[model samples]
Every structure is written in C-alpha cells, then in structure tokens.
Target chain A: MSKQKTEHRKMLNATQGLKNVMGRHFLAIEQAYRDGKPTAWATSGSPVELLYAMDIQPILPENSATISAAQKYSRDFIEIAEAEGFSYDLCSYFKTNVGAVISNADLTKGGTGKPTFMLSTDVICDTHVNWFEVQAERLKVPHYTLDIPHVVSNTNNRQYNYFKKYIAEQLYSFLDFIQEVTGNEYNEERAKQVTQNSWDLSMVWQDIYELRKAVPCPMSTRDTFGGLFPLFTMPGLKEPIKLYKRMYREAKTRVDNGIGALEKEEFRLMFEGIPFWYNLKFFGMLERWNSIIVYEPYTYAFSKYMNPKVTKEMVLSQPIEAMSELMLSFWYIYDLKTRIKKFEETVREWKIDGVLLHENLSCRPNSCGLYDLKRHLMDDYDIPCLVISSDMNDPRKMNETQVINQIESFIEILRKRKKK
Target chain B: MQKIGIFDSGVETPEEIVMAAGFTPYRFFGDPTLQPDRANEHIPPTHCIWTRNLLEQAIKGLDENIVGIIGTHGCDRTNREFDIWIECLNLDFMFFLNSPRKRDNLALNFFINDLKELILRLEEVFNIEITPGKLKDAIIITNKIRKLLKDISDYRKKLVLKGSEFHELVKNAQYQDKNQVLENLEKKSEELKSRAPFSEKNIKKILLTGSEIDDTEFIKYLESLGFHIVIDDLGVGTKYFWNLVDENLEPIEALAKYHLTKPINSIKYPSYERFNVLQKLIEDYKVDGVINIAQKFCEPVLYDHPYLNKKFKELEIPYLFIEATYNRESYNQLSTRFSAFAEII
Candidate 1:
C-alpha cells in the first residue's frame, strides 16, 4: 500500500503578521476572562462594534471553530457534542463550539469561557439564532437575536426604508440589552470612532480584493481564508486596520514584483461556497496542478457593504443604522437571479477559467441553490463548474482521494475547454 | 375562485388576508412519495425534503387557478426557495413576507408594517380593494375553523381515532376553500364529540414535536408500534390554528399580534420558549414520552437538539430523537427505531 504525501506551501509573507494579530487577540480574551471584564460571545456576522463601544470584549465562536478545524481538533470536539445529543448533521461550526464549551476549553483551544452574554444575528442565516439560543439557555445568560429581513428581490426596494428602520429598531433594543448586561452607559463617541474604523477597514479590504485581480494573482484562497480572521473578529477596532493596511502594501509589492502565490499560475478559478476548513491544504493540490483560486464569494461576502455606498460620515453619524445597513448588505441574502448576476460579474472581472462549488452538506444557506448556479455558469456564462461534496468543519464527510480524483478530472476538462 | 399558495411554519400569510383579497389560501405540504428530478436542479439533495417536495409540486404546476404564491421567511431552506420559485416557477404573482423572530413591541411594530405592505401588494396585484369589512368577515370564517379544530383536538385523549386520521383530515382542510373546510370541520367535530370513548388501557400517549412531518403515514406507523401520538408541535398540525386573531382590533394589527404571540415554532429565537410550550403541552396531554422527529437537514430543530435533550432529562421525560426524510426507505428505517423506542418506553 502506498500513501500520498500532503504537501504544504509557503503562500504569503502577510501570514506571519496575521499570526501575531491572532495571538494578541487570544491573549486579550484571556486577560478579559481573568480580569472579570464583561465579554460577549457572538456569531461572526453579528454587529460587534456595539460590544466594543460598550467595553465588552467580543468573541466570535464561528472563527474559533474555523481555528479548531484548521488545527485538526474539530473532529474530537464534534464527537463530544454529538455524544451530548447534538445531531451529526447539524452545522459543524455550532457543534464544535458547543463541544468546546461543554469541555470547558478556552481561547487557546478554539473556545471561550462562559461570558456575560451571547449575541446572534439572522443576517447570515436563521441557524445563528438557533445555535446561540441553546448556548445562552444552557449558560443562563441573556441572548439577543438581531433579525435583518431578507431583501429577497431586486424590485422589492419599495420597502427598503422599512427594512432599514426595522433593523435600526432592533439595534436600539440590542443596545439596551448590552447596557442591562454590562451596566455600561451607551457611549456615542466611542461608537462613532469604532464605526468609522470598521467602515475604513472595509474600504481597505476592498482594495486588497482588487489587488488579487493582478496577473499571477498574489494571494490564494487559502491565504485569504486565514487573513479574514481579524476582519471577521475585530474589524470594529483599530489594530486590524493597521494589519490590513500592511497586508495591502505587501500584496501591492507582490503584484509590482510579479510574484504569485504559486510558482506558475495556469488557471484562475473561483470558489462559490465555504472552503473545507479541515482540508484547506486541498487548495494546494489545485496549485500543484497550476490552478490558483483567485476569487471566493464566501470571502468577498464580508465586504458587500461597499456596494450600497455608505460614507464614513454616515457611519459615524448614525452608527446604529450603519450597523444595520452593513448586516443587510450581504449579497447571498438576495434572490438567486441577483446572486447569479453577481457571480457572473466576478467571473468576467477576474477572468475565471472555471468555478468550484463546495456543496457543503452542513450549511444549507450557502449550499442550497448551487446546482442552479452551476447550470447558469455552464449553460449561460460558458464557464465550467465542479461541485465537490463535503462538510466545512467535519472531516468525516470528506473522501480526500476521491476529491483529488474529481479535481484532477475537472482540471482536465477545463484544460480541454480552454484548448477548444 | 382564484387560489394563493402558502408555505408551512410561518404565520405571516394569514388566511384572512388572502381571503379578503378574494383568493383561497391553499397551503402546500410536499408529498413524501414523489421522486424529485427538476427540483434537484434548483435545490440540492441535502436540503429539507419537505422543501424539495414542495418545489417538485410547484414545477408540476400547483393549480391552473393558482393566481399567485405567498412565501415567507420561515426557515433557511424555505427562505431561499422563495427566490428559486421566483426565478423558476412561471406564476403570475409571488409575494414574500418577512416575519419577526423576537417577540417584543419593536418586532410587533415592524411586523405590523410588513403586513400592511403585504395587503397593499395583494390589492394592487389583483386590482381590487380589500376593505376592512371584508377582512373582518374573513377573520370570522377562519376563526370558526380554528375553534372547531381545537374542539376536535380533544377527541385524541379518548384514543377513539388514530392520530394520523386527525392530521390527515386537517391536512386536507388546508387545500379546500375556507367555507367548505369550516363546514366539514364543524360536522367532524360534532361527530367526534358524540362517539363512544375507547377503553384501551396500555397505549403510550406520545407527544410529537419538531419540524413538519408531511407524511401522516409515518405517524400511523408509530401508532402501529403501540405508540399513539395524542398531540404534536408540528407547524402544519396544531400550530397552524393554535391562536385566534382578535376581532376587535384593526385587521392588520390583529394579524401581526396573532403571528408573533402564537405558540413559538422551532425556528423562533430564545428556543427555550418552544421548550416551554412543549413542556406545557406535555403536562396537558399527560404525554408518556416525547418523539422529537425533524426533517433531515432541518437546521432549526437540529440546532435545538442538545438543549432540548438536556431539558427533557432534567424534567425526567423520556425523549427520543429521530431524523426523518421523505424517502420510503427512511420510513422503513424509522419503523425499527420506533419499535425499539416503543419497547424501551
């Protein structure tokens, strides 16, 4: 019997800076826990700027789950949750967080201690509320669900103001909930500063994405997946801005120097769903075949707020409404037609050769309508799409050898089509 | 009369509003027997089977008389299906309603405004006025059906009729016109009240909770295993008519209040409220044990499983979790699990 060796690539220089930033984040969480400062464990998509303004340390359990999966400890944590009655088919991210919590694992192990409160948002999906509610009930802490109504249609903008107001009102209620939990007065000045920082950071994030369009793309999907940590966890603070600014400079330099994430960039591919956290190295296999994933909707989705064109002054003047707008601007929350149009735009702009759709079994919101997307891409846009079935955080669902064979076959098809 | 299609689990599409708009509100429950080829093109196999079935039915043409369809932000699967239908289904009209997850004044206010917007859209699309008087009359007719259904719900305690029989009748009512359904329910409630009560001694009165089990035959099979489901927290069953809309308030406000204040569903937030409602039902029904059966890939119910398991244990209630799908093989699979579960309890 022969075993295939897993190859690791040194992708980017900015990776070291991300590690430093994440290490500091972990230490700060630990310090907050030890000092008895109020901390709130939140969903990755929730409005954490409010928590920061209120002096409450915000901990993102989703990012922590990603960290655990990358470290190869997610399967153990997942089994712990299943043994405690979480179904095997539920979102692995939620289960991993629950398992880590039940075992009293801390920040170092991709978990956080019992916090003063928990917060969730329906901006991404209804699963966030469901997952957080359970943790809040078990820990006997106050939980708040910020519901952002889905803008399901492009022509449904007649109710745009109402949607904005609905979310704004919920933001006020969330503020009250935070105040009650921490006994901290709502600080307007601090909120303004934080909102400004977040808006500024997103602009820089967009610039970084633009830089990925260079010939011989300077960053791979694997690098961006890790680089997105601080953007998701601490975007409301100033430190991420400095780090992101540094990353932008680094990518710009790479682009100017004609450097790439791979030795030879053959095909520019796009990824549609969440990457397999357990097997991020799988991306390296594509690189070995001289195919580099230049764009990912999952990563670009975090910066969709730039589309609606909100100025920094607007964000500072009405921080709550700004937060509401940011939560509501996710492109995935809209109609399938709109999403496909956006996907088509990216395929054209990035000059994509093929599309890879990860049909993650555990995430319905992200995986649901992907089959149609594949049809649209192939039939309408003339772009080849390959769907690889797996779970984002559950390695048990993946057959690596089978996936490798499928990718190799897909790349062969793309090569043939390119020759044609 | 023209028809307006509705989805299960969310109360945003009040039958009264659809009726006031001069349309029959026909709820869609995906069939468990049909194989889906076209729906698989739009939705993956990993989604809720109930949704896939619904999409299959829609593609097959729901009804020539279906003037429009009303979709709601019910769950993630159904929520996205709203978009898919708009793109795929060539219906004349479609409307999506956004329901609030939290039960508070602000949420209520938001929901009321949303309902008002829906009413306006219905009126504009049909080119007819939905007068307040028509809304009140529609509310009265729908409320009568709910009251009769509640009355008939009591007959389950006697074990006179099988749980599947009652659910089948209610499921059929959703497809019929309101007046016809109300009349049939009134007659059925009267007939059940006069029937002789059963004296079965050893039947386990089970409380079924979770997402909608579109197939009542599954319930029948459980009953065949000596476990009789006397009550349920299913969206299509009791929760559909659990609360009546207030007649005194303005129609839109009443609709908003009823939806937000009704028995919390699985997808709602602070999931403890759902457990609280189930706890009360367990006590009221004298439930021997709970069979938590949810559709495969139904995130709301799956996410609540661990917390619910803990709550049931703390309350010393015998609980079993079952993952159900629309496939015949899954039904057969459940039989063995049900048999062992029935024997253990």
Candidate 2:
C-alpha cells in the first residue's frame, strides 16, 4: 500500500474571522493586565455578562487551556502541574492552566495573567469551583463561587422555581462581590444589553446549528469546535453575535450549494465528548473514511439553551433572573432522560449514522453517562457506536496508532451496515 | 426495617430522613473486595473505584433489601453515577438530592426545598408520609449516634480507640438499623471512655483527610506503623457525623442546615473553612503531620491537594499524599512512604 498523509480540510470561510476575534480578546485581556484595569478570571460557564457590566474584564483560563492544547503545549503545562502535586487524574484543562500559571507561560502558550479576582460556577460540574479555588489561592486573588443548582428535570415546577430563585439570589450576591472588588457601580442597562447580546448570539448560533442538519452538513465538528470559542470566552459581547451571524450566512450558503465539509459525506457521526485538542487532525482523519461529524453535544453545548423562550422583558427588567436562567440552561446538567431524548432527536434530525463517544478521562461528568448513552442509541436505532478513551487536553493518554485502528474497524462496521 | 441505600459519602444523604421515611439508611460504600468488572463496562476504568464498586454491587444484586437509593449531588462522580444508576438499574425509588456546594442562606433554603421534594418522593413511592414530628424523632436518634461517635472520636485524641476500630464502628453504623447502631455506639463509647489510653511515647500523631476511605485494613496498617490517627476529614469519617442538627428548628430545615454547615468534603466550595476546621483539629489533637489519602481517580480531593499542600507548607507541617485504589497492590510502597513521613514528622 502507498503511504498517504491525512488531508486537512478547510473549515467554514467565516471561521477566518475567529482569528481577529481571538486576537482582540487576548489583546483586551493583555491591556487589562498592563493598564491595571479591574479583571477577574472566570470559568467558561460563569456569568460573564455580570463581569462585563461591572467593567471587569473576565479572563477564561479554560479557554486558554484549550488554546494551549491546540498549540500542543498542554502536555508540558500538564506535567508542570502534576509536579506541583496536582494528580494526573484531575481535569487536564485545569492542570494545563495551573501549569501555565505556575510557569508564567506566555500568552501564545496559554498563560492566563494574574487577575484581581476569580469567579467560577458549579453549574456544569463540581470540578469548577474547586479548580478555580486552587488558582485563586495560588495567585493570591479573592475568588467568588456562584452556586447554580443542577436542573435534574424541568417538569418539577416548584423545584425549578426554588432552583431559579436560589440562582437569582446567588447572582445578586455575585454582583455585590464584583462591586466590592472593582469599586464599580452596577450598570443595569449594560447588563441588560450584554444579556440581550448573548441571547441574540445564542439564537444565531442555534440557527447555525439548524443549518448543520442539511443532508450534507454545511459545518463539521472541527469547525464548530473553533466556532464555539468566542461564544464561550466573550459571550456577553457583540463580537460573537457578528461572528456567528457571518457563520450562519456562510453555512446557509454552503447548504444552499449542497456543499458538505467533506467531498463525500458517506456517514454522519455524533461525538459525545470534547474533541482531542492536541490532535484535531483526527477529525480530518475521519474524512478519509468518508465520515463527517455533524453533531456533537460538546460543541452544541455553548448554544444549547434549555429555556429558549427567555423574553426581552425578562432580560431587561429582571437581568439577574435572566442570568439565572442562562446559568441553569446547560444541557449536560439536565437529567438522563432529557439528555437521552435530546441525543435521539439530534441523531434523527442530523441524519447521524454512527456515534463517536470519547470517554474522556479528565471530565467525569461528560464521560460518565456516555457508555449508557451509546447503548441506548445503538439499541434503539441499530446504529454503530465506537468509544475512544483518552483525555481531551492531555496528549500523553492518546495512542494515535491504536485510535486509528479502532476508527478503521468502526468505519468498516458502519460501511457494512450501510451496505445492508 | 427495610433499607434505603445511600450513595453519597453520607454527608448529604441525611440518614435521618431515610429513618423518618421508615427505612434503614444503609450507606453504600463500594465493596473494596469486589472487582467492578461489570461497572467497568458502563463507566471507564478511570472513574473512582468507590463509585464503580457501588454500581457493581447494585448490578450483581448483592443487596436485595435496598428498597431505594438516595444519591446526592456531592461530587461530579456521585451526581453522574446517580444518573447512571437511574438509567441502568430498575429501582423502586431513586432520588438525586441537589445538595449545594456553597454554604449560604440560599443554599440552605434550596437544600430544605430539595429535602422536602425528597420527602414527597419517598412518601409517594413507599406509601409512607414523613411528618415533621417523625423527622424530629429521627433527628434525635441520629443526633444521639452523632454524639456517641463524637465521644468516641474525641477519645482518639487520648489514643483510646484504634483508628481501625473507629473506622469499623463508623462503617457499621451506616449499614445497621439506626436504633441498633445507636445501641452499639453507646456501648462502644462507654467502653472507650473506660479503657486506658494508649501510652506510646514514640507514636507519631497524624491527621487523615480526603475521599471516602472504606479500607479499614489500610487504617490498621497505618496504626500498626506506630502512627496514631488524631482526626480525619473523610466523608465516611468526621464529615458524616461532624455537625448536630438543630432540633429546635423545623426538621427538614434543620437537616439542611446541619448538612450545609458541617465540615464539608473536598467537593464543597469555600474550602478555607474545611482547611480551617482541619487545622483546628490538628492543633487540638497536636497532630504531627497530615496524610491525605484519596481513591485513585477521585477528582474532588485530588483537586484540593495542591492547596492543601500549600497550607501544610506554610504551617511547616509535614504532609504525605497517597492515591490508592480499592485493591491493595502497593502496601509495601505505602509503608515505606508512610515510615519516611513518620520519621520526619
């Protein structure tokens, strides 16, 4: 057999704008650091709108970890953190950030500069609050943790109301903390506008996702991985809205032209965990087997709002309440039945033929239900499913050759099933 | 009485509520002896062995008397494991209580609301109403057990109880009927108070902290090495019986306040209080060193190690970190490490 190199497929044209978005984001943080502006390192799922309204520049170390992993610098950073008594069993993203922070790595290599304060929420996972606490202590910065209750099931009205009220109260406390830290007045109109902007951006993101349901998916997981970046890091800003609007148009154009991410989209796969950041080319390698990952809960999570009917009135008049909803709206935090239903719906809607479940060792919450999820989908739909075990950011755990073999076998199985 | 299996480390499960609902609150620590072959198929091997062992036990039908399971949102593993059990097992009753990580009034209120929801579910499923009066009675019984356990734990400061013996008592307390456990604990506490304290001049005092440690053998081994366990912050240890429920308050509200204000595990936020609590214990017990023992792949405790290490360093306290699976594959290595840690302290 002749040797063949994996081809790197180009992502959506609008993704070009992401470079500028990322540049401006890091630059703003740099300026904040240099100019001694009020800044806080916030978790990706935190209420960045509140931070933005308070004129506190929110730096996302999670996003920085992602950037470091993509740059193949996470391994060294992770080792540095591991040497600092952080167990290798912990989250790779967190370790990478800790490593970068400890080593004082440069911006290009994912060093999140010290901030005046730190903020995190346990809305997504239990790891967030503790992880941020570690950094806050290390950096000698005061940290605030927002306790957002998990929405196990939305059907329980009284229970959900309590959860909402609890979260709203926490958000109010969060505002007080920010004000106390920054000595800045709470700008109600700016908070409202920021919330509105995030909502509008999420709506456009939802539209972009809808366009992915096209027979030949206009956008692939590889693109959405990058596309979801600004949405996470700069959610309350207008930049994401502009970028996502352009992405919607580009994806719409692709769908209109019947252009898929691949030359031949033979199989559509749904990925169930975070992508392997160090080897994103693995997504491209799947194209060699005539497969395109059109759906991933991990990617869509940035745009998946549990409460879509959050009104403008609610956003304006009750900004904290609206922020509470946004914080509680993460899909992964919901119950198993609801998440399974959404998974099945996406499989049918996106025409997914196979599922790639990455049992990421670092993220217990995301990886825990995946085995059962795979079983349910396969049992119900008779679809092919393959589980890849590795860490999302830690390259040490991934065996490229073994993963290739597994993918080849899974692709063969999918091909045979399709032939039937 | 029938049993309601509790899957948390027992901090947020509120065994009193289970007793109020007319069931034994059987705290399910994954069997250390059992190999979780089936659970490995469901969750990856990277998951903590305690959760995997619990799932394996449930899958194998090892405990048929468990009428239901009360899983709490204490950690990510327990939270998701609750979801997994709901999907994979056919239980008569399953409740995932959303215990808050933060200790605030809102969390207290939310926890009360959640406990009430749990009470309603338990009532509907088991055909039993958990009246506040019944709950208050359960609190008294549990509070008595807590007092007895606290008395026994205090004796450890005097070296009156072996670490292994205390671990056994705590472990057995979660499995047996609350009334029976209370009886046993009362007798044990009396025996401990009457017994002569251990008088070893060279015994090194050590504080234990981290994940739910079910391995009594490990504790026994540590004690055998001439190190006295002064206090523990483990979920199955002090965190289980640290705080007394305010019997003066409403039953559910008291339960909520008790669990929230207790010495929280590594998963809870505002970890300074937890550290401070441990520090206070260290000072009170005159602990020579600290040993944080976490189950391999346990996230919460492992995440807290760096911070804990920093605190220990600042106080010029010697600290040793150990990550062990349920299986004992490295006893010799651990003994060597512990011996070295002991000598330095």
Candidate 3:
C-alpha cells in the first residue's frame, strides 16, 4: 500500500475501535432504559454529561438547536422564539435554539422515548441559561440548571464546588421527583453502575478530538468529527465510547510524528461570523481560494476541551463530572483576549497572510465590533483584513455575486500584502 | 485639516462623540434616513429589509458634517459590509472595529490601541488629533451623559415614585440638553416618588433578548400580555451599555479598559464569564422570566441561547423563544406564541 493509504487505514482502524467501545457503553444505557430500571439527567457544563443527566433518550433543545442550525431550519424556529418574546439582536445561537425547539415539534432523543427532564448550566453562556429558563417555563417540565461560576483559569475547585452543590441538590430533588413519578427509592446500586457507563462513554468520545494525528488525517476531519455525533444523541450509550478507541490510538501515533492534516504550514484563517447558509457554498468556495478556515468558533469547536472543575463533588445530583462536552472543550477557556491573542499568535504561528471577517447579517456577536479588530490587525500586524457580509443560516439576506466579488478583492489585497 | 469621525451604530445621533472631539462627528447611520451616496446599495441591494430599513433611516438624515466616518461592527449589516463602498463608491476613510465583545482589559487595550492606530492612519491619511485632550474630553463628556441618563433611569425605577412615567422620561432624556433633561427627570422622579409604588401584583416583569425589536407593535404585544419588558439583550437595550471605563485611569486608559471589561455578545469568541450582562439585567428588573428573540439568520444567538437556556433552566426561571421575521403577515401567529410563552410562567 502507498504511504498515504497506509496512514488512512490506520486512522480508520483506530476510529472504528473507538466507536466499538462507545457502542458497549450505549448498550449498557439502552439496556437500562429498556428494563425501565430508572434514568435521570443532571447537568455539568458539557452536553455529553447533560445528555446522561437529561436521561440520554430525550430530544434536548441544546442538541436540536445546533443540528437545526446546520440544517438551516433554525431561522424559522427562531422566529417562533422571537414571537414568544425572544429578541432579534440577542444571540444567534439562542435563535437557533428557538428553531431547534420549534423545529423538533415532535422529534425525540432516544428511539425509545423522550427523556423526562432537561439539564443545563450557566457556566458556558449566559444567554442559554436564560434560554433554558424559557424552555422549562414553556415545557412546564421540572428541569435543573447548575450554576457554574466563570472558570477564568479552568480550575477544578470552582467546578467541583458548583458540581457538588447542584448535584447534591438535584439528587435530592430527583429522588423526590422519581418517587412521585415512578415511586422508586434512590437506587444507588443502579445509579452508580449507570453513571460509570456514562463516564466511559465520554472517555471514549474524547478520543475523537484526539484522533487528528494521522498524516493527511487518516480519517477525514469529517469522519473524525462525525464519529462524535453519537455523543449528542446517545449519551450514556456504549457505541460513542467504543467507536472512539480505535480512532484514538491511530491519532496518538499521528500526533507523535507531528503529522496532522490541517496542512500545518498554511495561513490558518480564524473565520468569524455565520456562514451564508444560502451560500453554504461559502466554505467550499473559500477553501478553493487557498484560504483555510482554521476554526469558526461555533459549538463544533466548543466541544474540544475537558472539564477541569468536575472533581466528583457532584454539582447537580448526578455524574456531571464524567460527561458534558462544554467542560470537555478547550474553547470554554477561550476568552476574547485569549482568542485575539490566539488570532494574532496563530497568524504568526500558522503564517497567516490575511483574515476574512464575515460580517454576518443577524449575528451581532461576530459581526459587531469589526472596525476595532480590523484596525488592530492592519496597524499591528500590517496584515490585510476583509469584512464580508452574509447571514448565519440564510442566503436570501445577501447578494452572493457581490459577496464573491468582495472576497475576490480581499484575496487580491492579501496577495498584494503577502508579496511584500 | 479634514478629520475622520468614528462612532458606534444605531438610532441615536453620535452628536456627543462628534461634538466632544472638537471635530464634527458625523452621524454615519447605515439607515437610509441619512443616505450619503449609494455606497451600500451595491454590496446589498435596497431590497433587504434590514438594508432598506437602514437606508431609510440614513436617508432621513445622516449628518454630512464630517469628512470621514467610522462604524462599529456591532451595527451588523452596514459596518463590515463596506467593501462595496470602499471599492466602488469611494469614501475618504472607512474604519471598522475588530473588537471582542467581552469585559476584559485586553479588548479595551486593543480598542484604545486601535483608536490610536485609527488616529495614526487618519493623521497620515487625513491629518486629524481626535487628540489626547479631545479624546479625554469626549470620554468625560460621554460619561456625564451616561451617568445622567443612568441616574434618571434609576430614579424612574424607584418603587415609591408617584405616577412614574418612564416612557416620557426616556423620550425626553434623548434630548441634547442635559440641564433640561435633568430638570425634567428630577421633576418626574419627585412626582413618582411622592406617590405609592405601583402594585407589582399582575405586572409581569420580562427580560427580552433579541435583535433591534424597537418596533412599537412588538413592545405593545408584550404590554398587552401584562408584561413590562424591564430589560433586554437587544442592541438598543442590554448590549449597548455592556462596556464601562475602569476607575483610577486616564480617559484614554479608561476607554481601553472597556475592551476587556465589556460583556461579550458574540458566541464566536469564547467567554466563560458569559451572561454577566444578562444576569445583571434580570436582577435589576426583578425579571420573572426571559424572552429570547432571535432574528431570521443570526449565528451568535444560535450559540448564545444554549448558554442562556442552560442558566435559566438551573435558576428555574422561565424563558420563551421568539424568532423574528420581516414577514409582517405572520404577526397574528407570533402574537399567539407570545401569549402562550407569557402564560407559562
């Protein structure tokens, strides 16, 4: 076999193994659900754990919102949120949240059934904590929102305190609710066994993010990222964890050799703002221009770190420490200063020539405050910056041709600067 | 020398920023009420509802007193989408911010540094000091206005006020005259405080989050539901006041302090200290529940809501989701959803 193909096969094998391990974890959870043993959701900052806490089988609005945004139905759903008293300029993610909730009008998480409750956290994003407030209020469901303080340095003390407090409270509450709803006592024996599976599932899933080590990326960024998809849907399930192991070992080798596929020596562009959904072609076309979008700073990137705060103290009356993607994502520690520094450093590190700031139509967060950032890039780095226009999910809001033309102009500026 | 004037976006005139700088701070509103030329029409046609609204507002009157204009990235549609104008239309200067929307000194330092950079470029290109003293004066003057306004708003919210009329105060407060505005506010506060507090019994306090839902009908709908939207995450409401200057600092230093200290509205930039702004709004208003309104194709909110929703769930505070559309025909359905959300909590 050729050197590239050999690498690819190794990557695939690793990913396949991880998936297998995750499968076992899922099987355990599914079996518990089928047996009607008892299940509950308590949340930490991570979606992975939240899935377990939310009972794993229920259609979570958080999971649904992101998927719906990617599906482009987020806007329609967001409109429902706005009508229900949400705001236009608040946050696009929240809008998609409305979209996810409204779009999933009837979607359930697990094939078995919708979970009994939703679990949440205020540690990651404030808008969402409130967004869940609206959801719980509307659903009239008894849910839990664990308030995690801002982990400025990503400390375990902070997370442990929060997790222990909320987990303890939630356990008592869950104990009461379970008795009232199912007339079951606090089933410690069953809960521990189930919680371990959930932890095993996350440990395996973490392998997916670590799987980018294969040269030419043995598996595609698509395959690697895709392997973790089950984490959202099948939290506490075995497949996600099982699938990650194979992928992990292959990635470990790749990382050892310093042979990852993101084209390590290229000018890594930190893409800001929403992609034109109408022009989902934006990604393809931009990539075609020799412009590599390093990270878009969405939830996709938010899932790249592990929680430093989960110290078995139990913040939400459940095993939040062992799960949840938020704590798992390195980006949770990603602050604006860090990001700006990263943007600058990455440009230096990745040999970036220019940055394409898509000033999205509806997302004020990414789109807002460009003059300052743009000015800094130009003055400090002497680099060219381009601020293009488009919507996050809808293309109807922009003129595609004009955008292309502007991008072309930006490319020219970048090339001109690069020549110097 | 012709000087360039940069200002934040939205409805209110940037007269204060302009006037205090000792140079004409032109109102560079993207809204059509102040149309300069067809600079933006090429990037996005006039058909876009937001573009059209901006053009209409700009056309009404964007003061052409300044030689150059600076726009914040916060204004979404018109600020960063200026390549069309810079390339095709030809303006003297157009600078956009690459600011991070979070309360951290780094961002503030970046902004002050950028302002200096902008000044340097403007000086090199247009020969303008927006100077240390002038910038300082601008900051001080701007602070005065903010303090005065904040005081009046606080006074209006004081529980013991008799027949307190905040709407009247908000309307009159926008007037350029500080003394007159203060006088009116004081008188209003006295009248309101003299009377007993309005019964909080049925008045549903709401925290609204979304786009520029400055429409009268939108506000009215909430009011009809017996909800008084006390605060919002809207640009015109919660977002604009997110940054503050640090004490024990020079005006320019203070300006820089705002960058790192401001609450981030963008989900693109990671802010673990998220919801600082929203939480403040909730506490200040004694908000019962929250309403997060998302615009048709916004991305930040898509990322923003989960964090907010997560918090609300933990707090057990009910929040509603409302998505916005330009399709006015859908108003009835929207109203029904609004009523349903309000009724839940």
Which candidate would rank higher by TM-score, 2 or 3? Answer: 2
lDDT of each: 0.81, 0.82, 0.49
Q: Judging by DockQ against the true structure, name the best candidate.
A: 1
TM-score of chain A of 1: 0.95
Q: Alpha-carbon error at A394 in model 1, in Å?
A: 0.9
Rank by TM-score (best first): 1, 2, 3
Best of the candidates, lDDT: 2
lDDT (10s digit) by residue, model 2, range A1-420: 122211222477778888898899999998988898999888877778788888888888888998899998999999998999888788899999989998899889988888999998887777788888888877899999888776553236777788888988888888888788888889878877877887788789888889989988887876788888887778789987888898888888888988777778898888888889999988888888888888888777776354766676777688887777767667656566677788888888888888888988888888877787778778976767899988899999999899999989998998888898
Taking the candidates in order, what DockQ does each have?
0.71, 0.66, 0.04
Contacts from the true interface found in each model, as a fraction, amount to: 0.80, 0.77, 0.00
Name the candidate that leads on TM-score: 1
Give lDDT: candidate 2, residue B292: 88
Q: Model 1, stretches more than 4 Å misplaced?
A: A1-10, B10-12, B199-201
Higher-ranked by lDDT: 2 or 3:
2
- DockQ score, prediction 2: 0.66
lDDT by residue (B61-85, candidate 3, tens digit) is 4445446656554433333343322
lDDT of 3 by residue, A200-251 (tens): 6556554543343222333343343335455555555555555556566665
